[model samples]
Target: MLLVVAGAGAAGSVTFAAQAEPADPLAVYAARIVGDRARTRIVLEFDRKPEIAVRYIARPDRIVVDLPSTVFTFPEADLEARGLFRDIRYGSMDADSARLVLTADRPARLVASEVMANESGTGYRLVLDAEMVSQQDFEKLVNDQSWMTASVDATATAQRGDRVGQSEPAAPGAFVIAIDAGHGGIDAGATGAATKTQEKEITLAFAKALFDRLKGEPGIEAFLVREGDEFLSLSERVTIARQRGANLLISFHADTLRQSNIRGATVYTISDKASDRMAADLAERENLSDAVGGVSDTGEPAEVSDILLDLTRRETQAFSISMADSVVRSFEGQVALINNPHRYAGFRVLQAHDVPSILLELGFLSNKEDEKLLLDPAWRVKIADLLAAAIRRYRLPVVANGG
Candidate 1:
């Protein structure tokens, strides 16, 4: 087994023992992680030089290395999470390809990544150096997707806006609504107190019910931001809405709070300053979804100063507020709502400059009563129906005016 320990100063050493050649064309026998929080280095010793492709992905900054089929025989602890990296994984992607994914703690870039032969020429070494960078620089790296990788997965392609079921253009005059189901995959949002059901499952079920309820309506097109139990960054959620040309974006979440007694639906719109302490605290927690899912929090979206864009945002915010009010009104007797249900906060998922967006807290999972209701299929159907009614009411005026 290869054992690695950091030495004094900025260097580290990996002790390896020679082993018999493996039948596989390529094999990685050793790997190590070196450096600190500001920078990180990863070295992998291979039996021979292997063709590699590197790509940078954003919406939670990650570096991906695509390689030919190979056997990874190193100990799992050799490349444990440390420094700038929050998590690391290497495994077979398919029968012919292998992948190494590195998720950063913050916006980062691979400053150096290359393969070179060892001094004795018996093997090759794959070295990668990652360093923290400004969000702008990292975004630039993500945008430059000129990697020569042989193929791009469906998810990656869809993330760039060519979704499978949504590639076809919406019928003209259709009022599109993008329903975002918050917290999935590695980030499970909140867990139910009684049933222990995950928030992701709840949101997805509600989102689907709402979508099914709305899809049959005339001149309306509803789609899910994340159709499955997969994680998406706050920005990606907003981007999906924008790319789909959605007139309204509604994000569904069920979160726990310090006050377990507080359990009810709340509609939130974006604001530079939160409407109250509760709003601020909730926004802070929800914004950390990326970090919780091993993706770096790149802070809020950049402030736009253009006069036209500013005006557009003001109009959009007004629409968002109106939608929130409609939601609260629709749930008045049909569903429970927290005090001051129409609140405003600087939620990243609601920061799409032109899209009218709102984050809807279905109900706190911390409260046993609310947890039971959140998990009840009948309750979900009732709530979804009410939400669909609210959407129709909010868009009625626009639809009437031939908008």
Candidate 2:
């Protein structure tokens, strides 16, 4: 075993080892982010040196670090608001690989990264340093850095390619609906106050129910973007719907509010500006799903725009508003809805440019009544049927005329 101590007066004082015995598994005991907006340093304390790979992605900008399966013993509070980064998350990406994703509030570039033994020679420390950069410089860095390496597994690359290429075109006159169950895996979304039910479970249950209901409809073909408890980035969700040629995308969610009295279903369409403060807050929380799920929020930046993309987004926004209205109308008597149920916000999951997307908040889990209703099987089925009716109403005219 090779051992050393971190530099004097560093952010953290910890001993580390460069390597460990083959029989020993590497474990991360503590992790923290230090420094200000201009510069940021990430420090990780481990039982042994870890094999790490780093890469950068653009849009909202982020740095992704891949490591061997690690046993993380850090506290959840460690992931709270940090300097330099808007948010940070770390978790197991797969059976063999773990991932740490950091979201930068502005353009940032990795300055230095290395794993060294602590000076006291007890354990290992992984240090990463980054600094803010101009947009042009960040773009160049993103273009230059490649995630793929010679050590990358060939089978994994092929599998990813196969998944992307396997999308089939939608049939003529068929109304394809992409149901996105909000929050999964590490991102548990909201939790019910009384029932302790997770927002992810609620959304998945509703999405599956709606999918099944749509299957029996004549001209409708529906599928789930995620079928199981798996995490997907907001951008990936949009990409999947677009790749599958989905005409409409409905993201199901059960959000919570600090105000326990605010307890009703609501429909949301994408907009650059939110309709209300509550809507804005909800959108912000929903958009953080990627960060919550150990995925960096490297979304496409708003300033980097194209005329054609703007036009497409405008057209899609119109359709999305219409769909939101349809759902609100359908739920008028069948289900309880929040006042001014139809709202608009900049929801990242609903930004497919072409696919008309709406986020349906089933109810607020913070409310006792809403929590009870959300946990009821009968209520779920009723809500799913109502949503299916709304979709059919929205699609019938377009599909009948071959749109």
Candidate 3:
């Protein structure tokens, strides 16, 4: 149902009939990407042409396609590294809308995009054409769409509270926590040798359990960055936490090491240099989530330079370290701990400049004992309780200090 052809041409308008009943939504049967470094074409076959809107975003340049809520049945492997694209991700944005995001390795310009009926007249296909452009031209494109950029900025400002280091009045009895369950959709993350379980599944299980426990606690409002099996860029994860005004961001994972003998829980705070070799390797693997999930690293440029921003980053990092210490202290004796227990690494998920964040490795799936414990419902409950306790302990002092 999908076809990719070279060259480009103008597109004609098309229309669809209204549905009377709730049935199956538009379905994508096939898709393909073609072309080389200069130009690229993308074709998506569907039961019928659906309404779609396209936009461009800078700072790791991307082309975003917004479509009516549709079901995607395409194989995950089909999206692996292809021409002009580092990665492609698509998922439901909400109840009535779906989104397809294409990450480009270089600045790209949209030549044409249109939905047209197949020549045979049975179905329709969405065709998109883009080509590389100079950095100056790309900057112009971004500026031409300044209105859209302003809207995005407004949304971010509304969501984020006080600027870094600037204390603001706290919301009465409100403590927001962002729980990120690492690796989802195409990125299965580490696999267990003994149980053949995937890290994504284990992280989601633990994250959900922790969310439920926190919801029951008074004055604590907790939510997951990802509610199901969907992919989110590393930057997106941090942005979501900050947008929701999260006081603390906790990323959960269960990774496997080459050496199966190493097994235990460990907590990591963000730092320029890793605390050890193991921590550095773990951070490297975790930071590759976007690439593993089929997203191209468009490379984000540094934000505007300011002394306030620098101070805010330092304060946030300090709070992150304090939170990590609390987690290690709470887990002591309650669960098996790694030698150091607490470490530091440059984890991308912990890079929000204003939010305190930490990455928690529940245990090693490579170890038989750790795998068994990770799969046990009873053990999960105990660990979730311990984490909630840690959060409570960290929150008390911050609330008292008006941090």
Model 2 residue 242 CA deviation in Å = 1.7
Instruction: Give all candidates' CA lDDT scores.
Output: 0.71, 0.69, 0.71
Write candidate 3's Cα lDDT for 1-403 as tens digits: 0000000001112121222222556788888788887899988888987988676776667777767657778876755547787877775433345567778888888899989999888889999998999888887887787687556434333333223234343467688777777876556677777767767767777777788888798887777776666556677777766666777766678887888888788888878899999999988888877655434354553777799989988888788778888888888988888899788888777766777777778788788888888777667778779888988898898888876
Q: How does each model score on TM-score?
A: 0.65, 0.70, 0.67
Ordering by TM-score: 2, 3, 1
Worst 10 residues of 2 by lDDT: 1-10
Q: What is the lDDT of candidate 3?
A: 0.71
**lDDT, candidate 3, residue 92?**
49
Rank all candidate structures by their lDDT, best first, as comma-separated numbers: 1, 3, 2
The local lDDT score (0 to 100) that residue 69 gets in candidate 2 is: 62
Clashing pairs in 1: none
Q: Model 1: how far is 61 from its true place, Å? A: 12
- What is the alpha-carbon lDDT of model 2 when measured against the actual structure? 0.69
Q: Which stretches of candidate 3 lie over 4 Å from their true place?
A: 1-25, 119-122, 149-204, 215-249, 254-263, 276-319, 333-339, 347-356, 363-376, 392-403
Q: State how far residue 235 of model 1 sits from its true place (Å).
A: 1.7
Candidate 3, position 270, lDDT: 78
Q: Give the Å shift of residue 94 in candidate 2.
A: 5.4
